[model samples]
Target: MTQAEANPRTMGQQETNLGLSRALPNGSGTEELVPSRYAVQVGEIEVLVISDGVLPLPTKMLGHNVEPKERAAWLDGMFLPPDAFDWSLNVVLVRSGGQTILVDAGLGLDPDLNLPRAGQVVRRLEAAGIDLASVTDVVLTHMHMDHIGGLLVEGVKDRLRPDLRIHVAAAEIRFWEAPDFTHVNMPPGFPDALRAAAKRFAAAYRSYLRPFDEEHEVAPGVTVRRTGGHTPGHSVVRLASGGDRLTFAGDAVFAVGFDHPDWHNGFEHDPEEAARVRIRLLRELADTGEQLVATHLPFPSVGRVAADGDAFRWVPVFWDY
Candidate 1:
């Protein structure tokens, strides 16, 4: 049955599969309130998963390398909507060594994609009792809107946290600065707007921008590993403390990566490189048994990678309510 058929009141119903209404819900006219923050301890440090919101991506936009039948079968077996992919937006809050660090900024305070479901990072943080001033650092996985969008809050950057420092990949900065860097799949003016936004953000936060390349520690227990493909400087972060280890895969892989590691999304700058990075990262995570914190996985996006023979599977961490 179609989404409209399932929820007769299309206007009031929360069609998570369709665009525009993904953040709001349907039924009773009463909004559903669920906890947007999840906390876990990495040794002595506290790690929180702050939800910006979710985006209902068209299924056709993902897994472009897979055969139509195979992709359909996989979606069917997973009991997912065939028409749209429910993608989650998650950012990490890390408090360690007396410092508060955020993995990615999320959609900031504005929805650059024009999707209402996004741009909830600040709200989620506030709900979690975290103040913007408390965050000392923000590490960008890449320069995408969904990731770096939260670096500034429209006109309230100083009010939010003027002292906050930003950590980004050197290659990512270079890619965005280039004259021809653009997303073929984005809207006509989206790329230009993004570039403009980047310039604006950098101008305001230039003193705080800390660019790095190769593998190195960004914080006391957090290190970023360069994994290009999804973007020129896309990277995955690793948090290690005591004997515990967790890897924030960023956009290196999404939920579909579990079953289709070789499949590439249409938005990737280099589809081949993206697939390669996903496969290599998946294998390492599976072999090492490290917990994964993905940006585009389900909410409370913490999981483990399990090796399914030659393929891989995403096993969401068990949450005890």
Candidate 2:
């Protein structure tokens, strides 16, 4: 069963509903204090961490070739249910040199993907005082639905940010647009929906889309690096300014995968290549003491990779606020 189907109620239903009408000390009540956005700095650049929401992934699917008992035991040890694992949807907004750049568009304005918890990036961005119209550029880490869905606005099907230039890896665009490109072992209609979304994004933003086949700097300190594996042309963003640097490792390492870099996630097209990329990236990040911003590693997802024996660990950056 899908996560949404298993839960029936959308993600965060209880938390949102519980705080909706609760009486507050101010007596006005009706205030829901949920975490939606966070802000961080990389030298002079400003980054706002906006949350699309959360989706529950099946535990078994996260681990490859592992016994059911092993997965259950690991979850139990971590004080979590064995059935579902929480997956966060995070995107970053970079403000530098008067340019407002969004890292990855979230699940857009629609919830048709059955991930009711997601599709809140636009709303959250507004709440955080970010003007979508002022966004100058959008950098897509991959053509995945959740990452690129928000590139287009709902209803009108126009570009979300009217004047923003969309940036993507040329290899990624080619891979997704290929006739033979197909999803393996995914759910029914999932593959078609993903392909359609990619095609739609390419078609809609063709005029402003900039596909980079080689490493290129989008801004003064932001560069896109080819890091394919999860997808044929998956890429990661690197930000360097003054003396600080951070890597936006999109989909490279999840929470569990942080410690178990060898595990093959079911979502990877080439599990071996994905594992290799994760391990090497994690090791480099850890050894060099660079910051990392991952899309799915919990809310306000900024952290550092750490060496843990032969494996690795994730150390979340302290909340600045």
Candidate 3:
């Protein structure tokens, strides 16, 4: 049976009922203080946005190209901290065409990085009653450590299906082989750590890799298109069904992007190209009025984009509960 069929309650129920009676990792039967998953139905397909916890990083990572004063002003206007803040890590579970597709795994355990609260995808998945083996396919937006680390966690491979298919852009796979860091302005140790994690993940899961050139349809109404910028092969996943649509925009757009699409993020290998890609994406999203989700927006980052003068605006959807 499909994972959805096996766990009908979790799939059928909405966020309002989540975490109320779910089992914890230690087998404790108790409700969590805060909800971490949100359910959205895109026609016949089922989309679950699971919070992978948060990463506390320097605020400058949001716009490394802009002046410090400009960055501070933006943070101040938003009432966020000037130095550092938590960047929400979100992972998605999509059930379509009798297949379960995990789009971007969260940051798995990386003790040396000192990010304690980030790698919770596995625990959260179990809490939601999603069996690792039940996952039929994984469509990676890119091979960034934060996007693929969950699968590299200890014992995670053994629990997954032996014949699982991992779909990713061929460009993404090639880019990581000899990644460029000349243009990026990441924090100390981040470049090496990201490099190590990506190398480890690729080495561990090479056999299951299915590389596509530009676009690939993993399931009905689900398409992943390559948009190189953040990395040489960054991409986004688009889902459409029964007249409803949503785009899981991996790293193409960030919270600051709505206000300053040209601001270069610290992790972008090609900041200028990344900025161009961001502008194009925001314009398309604003024109289409479809739902937008990303890896680093707020928790349950489901929203739509609207054209606001020359910039854009993020319009979050009202809860369906």
Report the Cα RMSD per candidate. 9.1, 8.3, 3.8
Error of 1 at 94 (Å): 0.2
Per-residue C-alpha lDDT of model 3 across residues 90-202, encoded as one tens digit per residue: 98989888888999999999989988889999988887777888899999999888999999899999999999999999998988898889998888999998899989988
Runs of candidate 1 exceeding 4 Å displacement: 1-32, 109-112, 179-193
Off by over 4 Å in 2: 1-31, 109-111, 155-163, 179-185
Using all chains and alpha carbons, the TM-scores for the candidates as numbered come to 0.84, 0.85, 0.92
Model 1: per-residue lDDT, tens digit, 249-320?
899987778878887775677878888999999999999898898898888878889999878988887773
Best candidate according to TM-score = 3
Residue pairs with clashing backbones, model 3:
none
Q: Report the C-alpha lDDT of model 2 over 245-273, residue by residue, as the tens digit.
A: 88888888877777678776766777778
Output the better candidate (2/3) by lDDT: 3
Candidate 1 structure, TM-score to reference: 0.84
Model 3, position 157, has a per-residue lDDT of 97
Lowest lDDT 10-residue stretch of candidate 1: 13-22
What's the number of clashes in each of the models? Answer: 2, 0, 0
lDDT of each: 0.73, 0.73, 0.87
Which ranking of candidates, highest lDDT first? 3, 1, 2
